[model samples]
Target chain A: MSRAWAVSVAMMVAALPAWAQDVGVVSTEQFESPRSGGIIVRVGGYKPLLDDEKALNGKTPFKDTFGDSSLLLVELELQRYFYQGIGTAGVGVSAGYGEKYAAAKLESGVDAAEQTALKVVPLGLNLFYKFDYAAFEWGIPLVPYGKLGLIYSPWWVTKGTDDEVVDGIPAKGGKWGWGATGGVSFLLDVLQPRFARDFDSGLGINHSYLFAEYTYSDVDNFGKPGFVLSSRRWMFGLALDY
Target chain B: MRLTFAVLLLFASTALGQTAPVVNFAVPGASQGTEIVVSKATCGDTRTVTWSRTGTLPCSSLVFWLSSDSNCSGDPGDGDLVLDSEEVPQNNTTTLSGTLELKMSDALAATPNLSCDTQATNKSYRVCASTKKQDSLLACDDTASGVGTPTIVFTLDPVAPLAPAVPTVTGLDSALSVSVTVPGDTSQMKVQVVELVQSGDDGGTPTAGAEKVSKVQTTDNTVFRMEGLENGKLYGVFAYAIDKAGNQSDPSTLATGEPIPSNGFYAAYREAGGQETGGCGAGGGGLALGAVVAALGFWMMSRRKLS
Candidate 1:
């Protein structure tokens, strides 16, 4: 055949949809993958917004104490998607932990070498609706999602001497109460195709996402009536969806 | 009556003008003079003086004396009289008289004995003799012999203090504890502690160029503590005593001490790699931002679903 015929044949092969092509190591799959039902584990850093907690953190070393303020946070979630009736919507349950610590050595006092820390754990269920336009043949790969959830977060003071108060809250026992959360996730696999590549056979991750979330947890004081142990925080983390 | 008057007058002149009796003092066989180390503290080791008459006149009694003043001009009246031996002169063929022993330690005793007082170290002492006789009326004689003569002069020298015993290391770790025995010879002295730098080859011996760590200001304190020392390093320690006069005693035997290992405090709190958990609690600003983003996401989702 002539060289012109060869070019035409190649063009035909490239034009065909991924499903009608032969199976190989590299397939012509675009953003046609499913958008829900996966396990996600994420770890990030967070800063609390409670006035008392903020005051205590501000006093951490060099601010009035001897050491700096730092907090560690982690989360794990399991989600399921229902695509038949409500477009692409998902429900997920997550458990997470956040700890903020500030240790200081008083220049002079009875409690010269005192350390204080606050730990909070949030466990909740949330509902999310994804805007995946590719399913309607719009040829868009982006999937932006919004979510709202209710959490019963338990918070306690980890390290402090008896009778010491951290940000107006008694740094002793823990309290569990109700709270709320709201956030949005942006699928990065649509922007970076490499994040969706399947390295192994069988069930594999199909998308990578980044999310920013806001949380407000209220752990009312078991003793003080007017005193409330409510706090707010901002968090950003990465998640993988299969 | 006139002859009797002349004889009484002669007797009165002899009694009134009786010349001072001559008294002699000597340390038998001690021609080079008496030498004594105050540290010996033994009375028998002291040099004793023998006295005899050197003039024609005879004294009824003789008294030996020791004084710190070189002149020895004052009798027992001068508080400088450190010792005295009062006795009748002995009758001998060589005109020998009484003997007096000088115990230097007695001069330095905490409680001095009568007739012999404690003598200060590093000083000169003179020995003399005085004679006393009763007058015709049996009253004490006013004129005494050897009032201005010092027969022998002895020097009091301090014995070198005993060196402190090799120190024993007690508490080791960042601080070194060493015990030094105050020299028995002196009670008012300062103890000096020296620390030797490790040459990386300190074979348990003090380095030639050792640096002084501290000086215990009080001799009463035998224990010394050296602080701010490097942990887990070898150091040689030695001590000496310094008297108020700046006399230094021999140094103690060298003692080697090594500090204990310290705990890794900073290492445990260093940065560690991995994901950190604990979500940030959202504030009003964070909530506002989240709501705006959520609204955009919801509107986009609704538009696509309707299409």
Candidate 2:
């Protein structure tokens, strides 16, 4: 009668939704699974490196020239793992909107200030390589990953220098351009819970991850001379994988 | 004895019919240093001359005259009879005192057949009244007003029209539709269109000559149909507004476009945001694509164990 009671309780628990991973003892196999495929969504912020001394507004920082700016980034990606924990290749599309740069006077003694904006919407095809140091019993729970990708981003400068004109047209905004990007992200798998033995064997699902990544992008100016749209920033966000 | 001498002098002045009347005289609408349009619709413009007696002495005859010369010394003859009390009742000192519409033909009647060059040329007028005969007592000529003399100046334009807006050129079959903003009223001004040519020299300094493509007489139409343009050759267009005074305003900004047929590929090229930028070279596109493909292939090969 005790054995039957134990069997019934186990069946009831297995039927429950896997809202969280079990917190059982972690093994190296979790990082090396070969059939993992899922989606990740993240929201973060970035700072523009507009203070390159070679730029037109070199003497002034981006925030000082355009007054109080914030760059907000939102990304959605689909990851297809060929080697699961060993390699994860994905395509991600990200949109970033920089807040209106503060009003600035194009001409001296003019009361009306010119307001400008910057935006970056990039579609990236990236390959991620995750190191499996845990498989060698390194005891380190942090998984380090490297990303390399080609970024096709449509960028814009709503208000540009007053004197800049291309072929009688304002040289402010244009079509999508090409760029290359590379970054490194440290995956914090240490915080993940290991489920009890009853839920150990199943399709992997319902995961929450915390990560921090630093990226550098080198973008072309379409045809604008003496103008560079390259930017670098560190991002921190939460990614839900399923 | 001194009182008797004064009485005799006054009697002699009255007996000789030279008793000059104290009359206040002016040419209405005639202001010192003010310009007047003389040859707009007719040979000369028109105005009125007014006169009044300052004292109780009734002046029998008052005359208004103009002289091409500033000095009123010579009798400018019958042509100078702008008005006379004997004819026009407005010349009378009592009844609103004489007022007559004065034109260049009537005022400068001495030179009745003379053609006036009404281009801001300064002249003069005079008003004289006598209590008796032709001996005038009160007279105000251009010189009588000192440096602020009421001179007769003729002009063609009081003000010039503003310049037209920059033109936009679009290619059509065998011609171009040049669009621009209508400056103002069509009746007051005419449009001047010029074709700009560049020699393609190293300097590339554009020179505009008497190469008039077309003249748009109507101000109501903003689009000028420009023809005789060479296909695929770039042309710069400019516009100007000529006022009634023959004052041509500065030309509008240059609008450069190449003419094309309806079926031409380059016809829509200019409208396709082609200005100020060339496409990424073929080499650039190929290199970027190649790099992406190469990186993806190498990455996939390194992880072939799972595949």
Candidate 3:
């Protein structure tokens, strides 16, 4: 019986190597989906420089009504990459909405029973470049980007329920200008590479990132003198590449 | 075993025959226990009551009555009013059904002693129904072998709610904002705006014109905006509250305001010689730009698929 037990142990030990080979437990190769475009959802504080118009001189009508607080702007941007060799180059379009409301004031300097609101819809078309080669090839997880864009902002002011009209001039207009933005994005795939590979294979999502950016915009109808919609703000949000 | 089965069958038959008839009542088209609110607006309406019964007891009639008592017990007292009687065919039917109409005017006339002036102290009555033998008259009494009586209540309300406080009026460009502090029991408020016509005589008070510009009603106590008035024109504002019973209160104290030209941010910019023509043209330009970008994105997506 002891001889039979020795033979059985030897046979089990010999099958272990074949079982390990079948499992194939150690592999670092990744199969990724094709990448073409990305979408970003961002929110930030935006305060238009309405009082900075040279035509306004010293009167701050926007400040007097809406105070110094900034409006919360929510924006969504869609990008399509045209080149993706060493770095990625793309054209992006963004749309955003922001509004501010306060109690309207009479000429007597007292708060009225009605509210006055300023609403704006900001639109943008941008050419952007992102340096993401290090994140993909060198195992680094940070991507830096830059954007130069044209901005068109439509603004309106309302007192009570109707648009304000002062001396036959209605309180609504649009401004056009240009802007430049710079941002840094942190890649989220490095923390769980296996899960990232699964995500790419199953959902066709190649990468995900959390990013923060600063924009310097001048949107006063290309300096023709109307409602100065220029603004400098910072935004933070998520980005998904598919 | 056969003898035991026969005894059990006889006992079950006796119990079924002795059971009281189960009676249920409802307002026709309404749920089982929905209360009928009788206000001045609905005082002339007729509400039909439907009753159904189920039992082995031999019943020949179904009678419905109204009582101020919650339990709907006892014979017809001074406070108890018999509504109507529905006669069923005396064929020993186990199930019976009928309907009776209760006129709100008659119910109100029945209570000449109680004041139905206000909803705060409103009067309520319960509807009851019972199945009885051919000659029996009283319903909802101890001697009746009927059970499962209805508990639907009818309330009478007639008076208007208290007037709201005086309104505070503010003037804007072509608009008037009216704010009223609503009373506790009020369910809604209405704001009325009228253009004030100035008198030609010197130092004469302006009179409100006959034509009203706007009449707005809201359930919330927030400020009401009356729009579409001429700028630089004086206007009169009035507010009133209404209760849930559809009764309107008296008009509040008059408040006056003048719609003047106010400068907003864009208006100020234009007044300062900022040359931006605002309207649908500028918005259309933005939309055109967005369409171009979207078209480019779709083209790129299709190109990638082709490759």
TM-score per candidate, chains pooled: 0.33, 0.34, 0.70
Compute the lDDT of residue B41 as modeled in candidate 1: 34
| Whole-model Cα lDDT of every candidate shown, in order | 0.51, 0.47, 0.73
lDDT of 1 by residue, A1-242 (tens): 69999999888888776646545455426433544464566666544333233223332222222123435678776666666343467776676787664543222222312244556665556677666555234545445566666554545544333233333434333333455556666666556555455421223566666777676666443222221345566667776655
Candidates 1 onward: DockQ, in order? 0.01, 0.02, 0.31
| Order of candidate numbers by DockQ, starting with the best | 3, 2, 1
Across residues B1-307, which tens digit of lDDT does each residue of candidate 2 receive?
A: 9999999889777656433345455555554224334333343566555555443333233334453443434343453443443232323445435554656545444555543543343234443333332324333332221111334343334344577778777654445667777575223323333456566878586655455476655556766777776766666777777653355667777766665533111112223322323333333453464356446545543443331
Residue A109 alpha-carbon offset, candidate 2, angstroms: 6.0
User: Residue pairs in steric clash, candidate 3?
Assistant: none
Q: What's the C-alpha lDDT at position A32 in model 3?
A: 71
The lDDT leader among the candidates is 3
Per-residue CA lDDT of model 3 for B65-128, tens digit only, reads 6766655544445666677445443344744777767755666556555433332456677776
**Candidate 3 lDDT, A71-183, residue by residue in tens:** 99999888888899898999888889999988766556667656778898888899999999999888899999999998888788887677877667677767778999999
What digit string (tens of lDDT, one per residue) describes model 2 on residues A1-242? 99999999998798664523565555656543334444455555655444442533334335444444447777655555555434344543333344334333322312222334555554556666655345224645455666666554444444322222324544333232344433433433444435411122343443445667777765444444422445576666655333
DockQ of 2: 0.02
Best by DockQ: 3
For model 2 chain A, the run of ten residues with the poorest summed lDDT: A104-113
TM-score of chain B of 1: 0.37
